[model samples]
Target chain A: MKKITIDPITRLEGHGKIEIFLNEAGNCEKAYLQIPELRGFEQFSIGRAAEEMPRITTMICGVCPTAHHMAATKALDDLFKVEPTSAAKKIRELMYSAFQAEDHLLHFFFLGGPDFIVGPQAPARERNILGVIAKVGIDTGSKVIEVRKRLRNVLRIIGGKPVMPSAGLPGGVSKGINEEEKQTIIEAGEYAVEFCQFALEFFDDIVLKNKDYVELITGDTYQHRTYYMGLVDKNNKVNFYDGLIRVVDPNGKEFAKFKGQDYLDHIEERVEPWTYVKFSYLKQLGWKGFVDGEQSGVFRVAPLARLNAADGMATPLAQQAYEKMYSVLGGKPVHSTLAYHWARLVEALYASERLLELARDPEITSKDIINLPTETPREGVGVVEAPRGTLIHHYKTDDEGILTDVNLIVATQNNSAAINMSIERAAKSLIKDGEVPNGILNMIEMAFRAYDPCHACATHSLPGRMALDVNVYDTKRKLIKRLQKNSCTTSTSGDGVGEAVSNT
Target chain B: MKTIILGIGNPILSDDGVGIKIAQQIKERNPDLKVVETGGVGINLLDHVIGYDRLIIIDSIKTGDGTIGDIYKLDLDDLDASMDLTPSHGMNIATTLRLGHGLGYDTPAQIRIYAIEILDNTTFRESCTKEIERQIPTIAGKIMREEQLCAIHTLGSPLCQPLQNRPVSKPKPRRAR
Candidate 1:
């Protein structure tokens, strides 16, 4: 028997499953993205000391630990009803900006970049960071590594470590930066800013210069018009560390802007039977069942959504990049899903610029970093624009600060509904009349990869890659084909495809 | 040799935290060894692993057909080094190592991987399952002995002495044998 295998499915075992139910005509009826979720986080949090949140939450993910740490620390600040000193906020924001820059750079060059940089139709072997290096030259790749190393050194200097930072306190950060440490960060920030500029030019030369790639970005197959959400400063500029939660309608008009604590008033989660991951949507609009556009409650969060929801970037260079993006894409609130990667680059520029700005601030080296909380602990919500998107940390406690309940609306959860929608849309648009092209797997994977959805909870085990399973069901409700991304593929051959796959 | 024992897993997840648990156990018997515990993967690992001579990575694996507490020792060659690490937060061990080498970062000269076959990694808890929890000390001892360090006596054993940072200080509760 010739080894019958699906190409991209075996390559990416990101633990993401796509179940496509086909109609009688062989067209896709429904496509469900079943993501394996780590269970009982709320149960895990209750009874722990509220102050331990910042440290404990960081362990929840292998990636985005910094994001979790920040959100949790902010939640403590809110819970204690204490405001951080100005210096502390700047120090925190500086660290956050560095993290965002490094993370976005990695995602672009490694995860999402391959689809466009190396060309989506490229061979599976060349669709990775190595492929990216092959195209962009070793010099750029070396530069990326250098820049990331410098930024991580800044993280180590301030956060005490790069992966999990213990610098956050209830009222403010645990420590402040001195002049020498500040100097190191300044150098890193300056170098990062330069690299981000190079990155924008690189994007122009690589992605934008390619007509086919641009069309794919703006194309309808990977597009969805949905309400966007993010954190915006008083001037309606994007801020990763802190800001009001802003929601924009599908037409790019501000729908609502409120404090982070008021998130419950706007957002709600809908649970589906097939998957542990809950679909979050606008509470006011109601759960309209995975539909996009204005009336549907389905909203999106993350890089693209942040760009769509915010008015502009905070820094000058990022603002110019932001303007260029909007002008090229035709307007605010770009509904193109693939544009998320483009928005990510724009945000990366802003993050790098913001890091430099914060580093240059004279107040960044102040000694007065933290303030003691006076009020008794109760319920509080802390929200930040994580590298992926809006991350919310909600905590309810008794008078003593023992956590009675904890809720974390991670970046991935916010985009779960939109991710499913994008996947289904791509599947429906690509899988016409039951042909079920093996090529469509990459197309569908590209849809989820746009958001860079990190399901690290259930993926802390070995193999180090997320597995994607594609199950295509016929009209008779029988399992026609099963592809176990990391293992093997068994097509619908009626000759015990299930048995042969099970044996393998 | 400047050996660094890296325990990679979510500490709160049952069985998933076996790596950290074993690292902690190894630390108990050999307090002077340079042991690092991290829930991070890919390039983030380069942050801790730079300048180390040997990297012994202990992680949890759920490969089918393995016993619950079975320990499988693997090297970099055992896994597909060029596997596409599209998702799962960052790059895999192979890619991270290659990237580190490419960038002229003094990554570990030699690497060893101890993948403990696990039963459950999804449930949110700080303790491993009863099956795997029992063999953690034995497993830790085996890994240390494999590294040419006597597990019983390390104070005057004249064995593997490494100098560095130990991030996670929380040790698992050890039972009397």
Candidate 2:
């Protein structure tokens, strides 16, 4: 048996390495998923003012700043025991949906779409959207650019800027939208809805045209069922902001539902020496490793998880898509992680429909957008369903509202174990005879990208000096190949181009 | 004609956010200036710099033995062939600028870099050190003056501010990475 290693996957966020160890017996010996550095954001946030957390924590990850901002705000609200007004909630939801649309678009088109469209071996220079424009039509490229701009415009109108919006606050948003701003949101929403629909059709066409890649879709089913968790309203509709925490099993069995403040009871985190990141699992079932487990405590979050946990989406189109997803994936408990992209696209459609509904709601245009908090508590926990997964922020404050402690569980952290599992499975199935099939490694990386893991914000480490190692072995447990790569291309300070190589 | 001033740094890592803070101040003073805060010089940097005619880059540099807040302005043409000036995430800013230049897409002709000398880069606190924070306004002022000079130079007008009167500081020593 031979071993193969690939260190520091390139064009991705954060610092992580995948190691596959096979023994002389031709069997898999060990699979190590290592994130070599620890970012103690929570520990360092102990003395800061809780009110500043929304902005402060937004620095955690550039890719998902909106999610961190929302979660931090929610967490502060919980600590203060303040509930935002209905209008405030709607505006916040709208802003988050816009962020989701933009983020998903970037991930799909710019980040992951290149591998699927241009083929994995394409040179890095030609592997981007520009390359897509060269190969496909200029129309597709322009459409992508147009969609991103519209989405960014929506975010700017709501959050005051596109990347990290300062609109979110403890009790409610810092400001409210005026008539003109509301109109802008409505127009953007209308355009976004139409644009998203067109993009979905385009993605579907891509999938249909490439029948060999259909397995990646899981036939419109919920792929990785495990246990689902998210925030859902009293009407059992999915919500990005302000809802109770709900968890369900693979068979769509409701196991537990708790208020956001009670999340500590259900979730527990485990640390491994191999990686700086920790694996969080359901506390009741105990730590059941990544691979085989009774679907009892294996929890999944983000778009797919949120969809599975909710009874139905607020919009008819989303409801229809959700039902179709359930029907296609054999009615829940999707074990295959690759199906997340489908769920993300479905949620994107749902978000667009929801945005349209909110825009048209007569109450949305009302000037009463913010409901301020009159008092403050010593602690709060804010939970929201980010585009990628469930995001939770817990903060403890002094009597004067100074932050004393901050705990954040981002979307990617919720899916950490599953991400490791998917990588291992993909490695085992794809790496053969010490040779990685073309696109196989890329497919495995794509599997991780499906989760859209934000390692930079999720983990605590500097940008450079990161390493990743992958090892593969044959059935006889003999080492076939070992691949080790660093993320930095030129400087050892880890401040260079992030490049990863798959060695045969 | 639209200007995007990208401030690149790791906020949690002390002075890395100097560029971003400077950009923010400029945006506040001049609403017309589009200010963006980025983590590093990567592919995202390339994306942000595209379409902007004037690029102002701010970052923290540990240039050997230079006093903190020493400002430096280097033309893109002066960059060495082997300089690893790219960011840690995507492509480097230098490469991106070069790429845009090669593509015949009229790259930013006026590029300015204001690098703050960092004493510490490991802290996770929000506020920077007293020395760096104090220099923010000074850096902002200097950048504004430079922009005026650039504008005047392009117009071929007589110097409003005497460039010779300002003390020419020594270039900071380059540290081995």
Best by lDDT: 1
TM-score of chain A of 2: 0.85
In candidate 1, position B65 carries an lDDT of 45
Looking at candidate 2 chain B, the ten consecutive residues that score lowest on lDDT are B80-89
lDDT of 2 by residue, A124-150 (tens): 345555555566676666666666677
lDDT of 1 by residue, A18-89 (tens): 899999999989999887678887898899999999988888887788999999999999999999999999
True C-alpha contacts between chains kept, each model in order: 0.40, 0.04
Report candidate 1's fraction of native contacts: 0.40
Task: Point to the candidate with the largest DockQ.
Answer: 1
Query: What does DockQ give for each predicted structure?
Result: 0.27, 0.12
Question: What is every candidate's alpha-carbon RMSD to the true fold?
Answer: 6.5, 8.1
**Model 2 stretches astray by more than 4 angstroms:** A1-15, A36-38, A120-126, A216-225, A328-330, A433-440, A458-504, B1-5, B18-51, B56-123, B127-177
Model 1 error, position B175 (Å): 20
Considering the two chains of model 2, state its CAPRI-style docking category: incorrect
**Tens digit of per-residue lDDT, candidate 1, span B1-177:** 898899888888888899999998888877788898888877777778899999999888775445676666666754543356364555667777876777677999899887777888888888999999998987787677666545544454433322122224435658989
Question: Residue A410 lDDT in model 2?
Answer: 73
